[model samples]
Target: MQTFTLNDGNKIPAIGFGTFQIPSDGSTYKAVSAALKLGYRHIDTAVAYFNEGEVGQAVRDSGIPRDEIWVTSKLWLQDYGEEPAKKAIDLSLKKLGLDYVDLYLIHQPYGDVPGAWRAMEAAKQAGKIKSIGVSNMTPKIWQQFVPQFDTLPSVNQVEFNPYFQQTALRQILAKNDVKLEAWAPLGQGNQDLFKEPILNGLAEKYNKNVGQIILRFENQEGIIVFPKSVHEARIKSNLDIFDFELTADEVAQIRTLDTGKGMHDPDAPGVGDMLLSGVRFDNVAQKDSQKSNR
Candidate 1:
C-alpha cells in the first residue's frame, strides 16, 4: 500500500478501510475480519461508531501481527476534556484489546477541543498512540485551534471528493505540512459524483470504475482515503490504483470539478451546536461512561 508521511515522521497507508455505519451486530466483526484478510491493513473506527471492540476482535482473529494493522479510533465530543479524554484513550485501548493504536483523533471540533487535543498529544508522547490529529476541523476551525496547541496536528480529515473539493483548505494544510484524510472520497454514494463526465472519462481511460478513478485522484493528490464497503469485490477493487497514474492535465481537469464547498463546515454558524446536539452513542462506550461517573 502507498503511504503518506506524517509531520511526526510516521507513515500512514494512503488507503484504508473505513468502518463507519457498519452495523453493531456481529456483521462489524465479520466485515472487519474479511477486510483484514482481503489485504486492508488500516481500519478506521471510532468510539462514536460503537464498534471498536468488534474491530479489535477481527484484528485478533486475523492473526495479523498487531504492528501490521493500523487501528484508529476517535475522541467523541462528549469526551473532550483533558482528564476525561485521557480516560477515553485508556478506555478505547481496553476495548480494542491492544496496547496502542496507530492513530487517535479528536473526532469533531466542538466541546473542550484544546483539552481534548492536549490529551491526544500526551498520549502520543506516552506511546499509547503513534500519531494524533483532528477530523472535520475545517480551515476556519484550524485557524482557531492550531494557535492554541503546541503540537501541530499530524492530519486533518474532512469531506473530500470531486464534486466538493476543498481547494483553500488543501493549500492551508499543504503550507502547514499536515496530511489530509478524506472520509467520503467516493462522495458518500452521491450519484452525482459517479455521474460526472470528467470522472467517467477518466474511468474509461484507466479501464477502472468511477470509484477507482475518484480514489486514484486522492492518491495522486496525496490525500488519505478511507472508502467503506462490505462487498468483497469492492473491498479489493478499491485498493487497485497503484498500477495506473493520472496525468497532470487529467488531474487538473478533475480539480476544476471542485466547487469549493463540503458539508459540516466548522466555520459555518450553528454547525458546532448542531453537531454536538446530534452526537448519540448508547453502546459499550456509553455504558463505560456511566461506570466512570459512578
Candidate 2:
C-alpha cells in the first residue's frame, strides 16, 4: 500500500476511504465494511459527519487489527475552545470506539483556532492523536495558523482536483513539509469535469475511467486522497490506481483544467461568517435516531 510519510514520521495511506455525508443508518456501515474488505487501510470521518459511530463499528467488526487501519476524524467549529476541543477529541475517540486516531483535523478555519491547536498539540503529546492537521485552509489561512503551533500541520486537507488544483497552496505545503490530502478529489463526480477532453483522453490512453485518471494524477503529484463512494465497485476501483503512472505531458494537460473553482472561497470577504455556520449534524443525528426508534 502506498503511503505518505507525515512530518511527524507517521505514515498515512496514499488513498483513504472518505466517509463524508455517509448516513449512519447502515449505509456508512456497509460502505465502510466494503472498503475494509477491499483493502482500504485508511478511514476518514468527522464529528460534522455524524457517522463516526457507523464507521468505527465497521472497522471493529471487520476483524482487522486496530494497528492496521489509519483512522482520521475532525473537530467541529462548535468544539473550538480549548476545553471544548479537548473534550471533543475524547468524545470522537469514544464515538469511533478507538483509543487513538491516526490523524485529527480541525474541520474549518473559523472559531477559537489557537485554543483548539493548543488542545490538539496536548493530545499529540499525550498520544491520543498520532498526528494533527487543518482542513479547508487557504494559503493565507494556513500561514496564519502555522505560527501558532510549535510544529507545522502534518496534513492540510483541501478540495483539490483538476478543477481547483490550489497550486499556490500546494507550494506552501511543500515548503513546510506538510502532506496535502485532497478532499472531493474527483470533483464530486461532476460529469462536465469527467467529460473534459484532457481527462477523457487520458482515460482512453490509460484504459481507466476518468475518476481513475484524476486519482492517478493526484498520486503522481504526491497528494493524498480520500475519495468518497457508497458503491462497493467504485470504492474498489478508486483504490486501483497504484499500478500506473501518468506521463509529464498528461499531468500538464490535466493541470490546464484548473479553473480555481472550489467548494468555498477562503479569501472571500467575511468568509468566516459563513464557515462558522458550518454543517449542522445534530439535526441529521436526531432524524436518524427517530428512524431507528421506529
Candidate 3:
C-alpha cells in the first residue's frame, strides 16, 4: 500500500478500509478480517460507530501483529470537554483492545472542541495516542482551532470525493501540513459513480473497475481514502488500485464531476441538532437486529 507522511512524521497507508456503516451485527468482524486478509493495513472506526469491539476482535483473530495494523477511532460530540475527552480516549482504547491507537480524531467540531483538542494534545504527551486529528471540521473551524494549539492536527478527515472536491479546504490543510483523509471517497455510490462515462472508459482502458479508477484518481490527488466494502470481491478490487496510475488528462476529465456539495453538512443550521435528535443506542441495537434477521 502507498503511504503518506503525517505532520508528526508518522506514515499512514494511503488507502484504508472504513467501517462507517458496518452493521453492528458481527458483520464488522467479518468485514474487517476480510479487509486485513486482502492486504488492508489501515482500519478506520469510531466510538460512535458502536463496532469498535468487533473491529478489535477481528484484528486479534486475524493473527496480524498489533503494530502492523493501523487503527483509528474518534471522540464523539458528547465527549467534548477536557475530562470527558480524556475518558473517551480510555474507553475507546478499551473497546478497541489496543494499548494505543495509531490515529485518534475528534469526531465532529461541535461541543467543546477546543477543550477536546487540549485533551488530545495531553493524550499525545501521555503516549495514549500516536497522533491526533479532527473529522468533519471546515476551514473556519481549523482557522480558529489551529492558531490556538501548540500542536497542529496530523490529519483532517472529511466527506471528500470527486463530487465534493474540497479545493479550498485542501489548501488550508496543505498550508498547515495536515494530511487530508476522505471518509466517503466514492461519494457513497451516489448518482451512478461506477457508471460514469469517463470513469467507465478509464476502467475499460486500465482493465479495472470504475470504483478503482475513481480511487486511483483520488490517490494521485494526494488525498488519503478509506473506501468500505463488505463484499469480498469488491474489497479485493479496491486494494488493487496500487498497480496503476491515472494520466493527467484522465485526472482533468474526472475533475469536471465535482459538485461542491456534501451529503451531510455540519455547518448547516440545526445540522448538529438533527444528528443528535433521533440518535439512540436502542435505535442502533434495533437496526443491528434487523440486519441480522435479514
Candidate 4:
C-alpha cells in the first residue's frame, strides 16, 4: 500500500477500509476481519458509526500486530467541549481496546471546534493519537479555523470525487501542506459516474473497472481514498490500485469531469442541528458524563 506523509510527519496508508454505514450486528466485525486478511492496514471509523467496538474486536482477532494497523476514529459534536472531548477520547480508546488511535478527527465543522481541537492537540502531545485532522470543512471554514490554532491539521477529509473535485479547497489545502482525504471518493456508487466517457475511456485504457480508474485518479493526485464496501470482492479490488499509473495528460482528462461542486453542503441549514440531534454517546461515555455531574 502506498502511504502519504502528513504535515505532522506521520505516514498514513493511501487506501483504507472505511466503516461508516456498516451495521454493527457482527457484520462489521466479519467485514473488517476480511479486510485485514485481504491486507488492508488502515481502518477508518467514527463514534457516530456505532461500530467502533466491533471494529476493535476484529482488529484484536486479526492477529496482526497492533502497530502494523492504523485505526482512526472521530470526536462527535456532542463531545466538542474540552472536558467532554477528553472523556470521549478515553471512551473511544476503551472501546477500541487500544491505547491510542492512529488518527483522531473533528468529525464536523460545528460545535466548539477550538475546544475539541485543544483536546486533540493535548492527546497528540500525550501520545494518545498519532495525528489529528478535520472532516467536511469547506475552504472558507478551513481558512478561518486553521489560523486559530498553533498546530496544523494533518488532513481534511471531505466529499470528493471525479464530478465534485473541490479544486479551490485542494489548492488551499495544498498551500497549507495539509493532505486531502476523500470520503465519498466513488460518488456514493453513483452509476452516472460509471458511464462517464472520460472515466470509461481511462478504464478501458488501464484495463481496470471504472471504480478502480477513479480511485487510481485520486491516488495519483496524492489524495487519500477509502471506498467502503461489505462485499469481499469489491473490498479486495479496492486495494488493487497500486499496480498502474496514469500519465499526466490522462490524469488531466479525468480532471475535466470536475463539476466544481459537491452534492452535500456542510453549511446547509439544519445540517448542524440534524447532526447534533443524532448524537449517541456510548454507555461508557454516558457513565463518565453522569459521574462528572455528581
Candidate 5:
C-alpha cells in the first residue's frame, strides 16, 4: 500500500476501509475482520457511527499488532468542550481497546471546536493519539483554526468524489502541509457517477469496475480515499488500484467531472448552524430539526 507523509512526518496509507454505515448487527465485525485479512491496514470509524466496539473486537481477534493498523475516530459535536472532549477521547480509546489511536479528528467543524482542539492537542502531547486533524471543515474554517494553534492538522477528511472535487480546499490544505482524506470517494453510489463516459471508458480500458476507475483517479491525484463496501469482491477490487496506472490524459479526462463543490458540506450556511448548535447524532430528532429548520 502506498503511504502519504503527514505534516508531522507520520505515514498514513493512501487508501483505507471506511465503516460509516456498516450494519451494527455483527456485520461490521465480520466486514472489518475480512478486510484486515485481505491486507487492509487502515480503518476509519467515528464515535457517531456507533460501531467502534465491534471494529475494535475484530481488530483484536484478527491477532494483528495494534501498531500495524491505523485506526481513526472522531470527537462528536456533543463532546466538544475541553473536559468533555478529553472524556470522549478516553471513551473512544476504551471502545477501541487501545491506549492510543493513530488519528483523532474533530468530527465536524461545529460546537466548541477551539476547546476541542485544545483537548486534541493535549492528547497528542500526552501520546494518547498519534496525529490530530479535523473532518468536514472548509477552507475558511481551516484558515481560521490553523492560526490559533501551534500544531497544524495532519489530515482533513471530507466528502470527495469525481463530481465534488474540492479543488480550492485541496490547494489551501496542501499549502499548509495537510493531506486530504476522502470519505465517500465513490459518491455513496450516485448512479450518475457510475455512468460518466470518461470513467466508463477507463473501466473498459483497464477491465475494472467504474468504482475502481474512480478510486484510481483520486488516488493518483494524492487524495487518500476510504471506499466502504461490506462485500468482499468490492472491497478487494477497491484495493486493486495499485496494479494499473492511469495515464496523464485519462487523469485529465476525469478532471472535467469536477463541479467545484462538496456533496456533503458541513460548513454550508444552515448546515454549519445546525452542527454548531449541538446536533450530536443522525437520529430522528436531529433529522426532523434539520428538515424543519431548512
Candidate 6:
C-alpha cells in the first residue's frame, strides 16, 4: 500500500477501509477482518459509528503487527469539552481495545472544538494519539478554528469526490500543509457518477470499475481515500487500485465533472442542531433504554 506523509511527519496509507454507517452486529468485525486479510493495512472508524469495538477486535485478531496497520477513530461532537474530550478519547481507546490510535479526528465542527482540540493535543503529547485532525471542516471553519492552535492538523478528512471536489478548501488545507482525506470519495454511490461517460470510458480503458477509476484519480491527486464496503467481492476490488495509473489528461477529463456541490454542507442552517441531536454522553443511557423499550 502507498503511504502519504502527514504534516506531522507520520505516514498514513493512501487507501483505507471506511466503517461509517456499518452496524456493530458482527458485520463490522466480519468486514474489517476480511479487509485486513485482503491486505488492507489501514482501517478508519469512529465512535459515532458505534463499531469501534468490532473494528478493534478485527485488527487485534488479524495477526498483523499493530504498528504495521494504521487505525483511525474520531471524537464525537457530544464529547467536545476538554474534560469530556479526555474521557471520550479514553473511551474510544477502551472500545477499540488498543492503547493508541494512528489518527484521531474531531468528527464535526460544532461544539467546543477548541477545548476538544486541546484535549487531543494533550493526548498526543501523552502518546495516546499519534496524529490529530478534523473532519467536515469547511474553509470558513478551518480559517477560524485552526489558527488558535500551534500544532497544525496533520490531515482533514471531508467529503471529496468528482462532483463535489472541495477545490477552495483543498487549497487552504494545502497552504497549511494539511493532507486531504476523502470520506465519501465515491460520491456516496451516486448513480449519476457511475453513469458518467468519462468515468465509464476510463473504466473500460483501464479494465477497472468506475469505483477504481475514481479511487485512482484521488490517489494521484495526493489525497487519501476510504471506500467502504461489506460485500466480499467489493472489499477485495476496492483495494485493487494501486496497479493502474491515470494520465494527466485523463485526470483532467474527470476534473470537468466537478459540480461544486456536496451532499452535506456543514455551513447550512440548523446543521448544528441536527448534529447535536445525534448522540451524546449525557443521553446514551436514556437512548439505550428507549431502544430496549422498543
Candidate maximizing lDDT: 6
Residue-level lDDT tens digits of model 5 in 1-294 = 799999999999999999999965688888999899999999999888877777787888898998899999998988888998998898788777778999999988875888999999999999999999999878888877668767888999898999998988999998888999999899999999899988998999999999999999999999999999999998888899999999999999999999887667666679767756754554532342233223
Q: Supply candidate 4's per-residue lDDT for 232.
A: 100
| Candidate 5 segments exceeding 4 Å error | 277-294
* Backbone clash tally (model 1): 0
User: What would the TM-scores of all predictions be?
Assistant: 0.94, 0.94, 0.92, 0.94, 0.93, 0.95
Residues 1-294 of candidate 3 have per-residue lDDT tens digits of 789999899999999999998876688999999999989999999878888878888888889998889999988877788997898787777776678899999887876788999999999888899999999988877776678777889999999888889988999988878999998898898867767899899999999888898899999999999899899999998889988889899899999988888888777898767655535443453343344333
lDDT of 2 by residue, 1-294 (tens): 888899999999999999998878799999999999999999999888888878778888999999999999999887798998998888787777778999999888887998998999999999999999999899898878778877689999988988999989988889879999999998887888988998888889889998999999989999999899998999999999977899898888888889977876877888788767766555564554344334
Model 2 RMSD in Å is 2.6
Which candidate has the highest TM-score of all? 6
| Each model's total of backbone clashes | 0, 0, 0, 0, 0, 0
lDDT of 4 by residue, 160-237 (tens): 999999998989988879999999999998899989988888788878999999999999998999899999999999
lDDT by residue (tens digit), candidate 6, 1-294: 899999889999999999999887789999999999999999999877878878888899899999999999999898898999998898788778789999999999887999999999999999999999999999988887898877889999999999988999989988878999999999999999999999999999999999999999999999999899999899999999989899999999999999999999999999988888875644552342233223
Q: Rate the local accuracy (lDDT) of all candidates.
A: 0.87, 0.87, 0.85, 0.89, 0.86, 0.90
Off by over 4 Å in 2: 277-294
Residue 195 in candidate 5, Cα distance off native in Å: 0.6
Q: Where's the lowest-lDDT run of ten residues in candidate 2?
A: 285-294
Runs of candidate 1 with Cα error greater than 4 angstroms are 278-283, 286-294
Model 6: lDDT of residue 100: 97
Pairs with backbone N, CA or C atoms under 3 Å apart (clashes), candidate 1: none
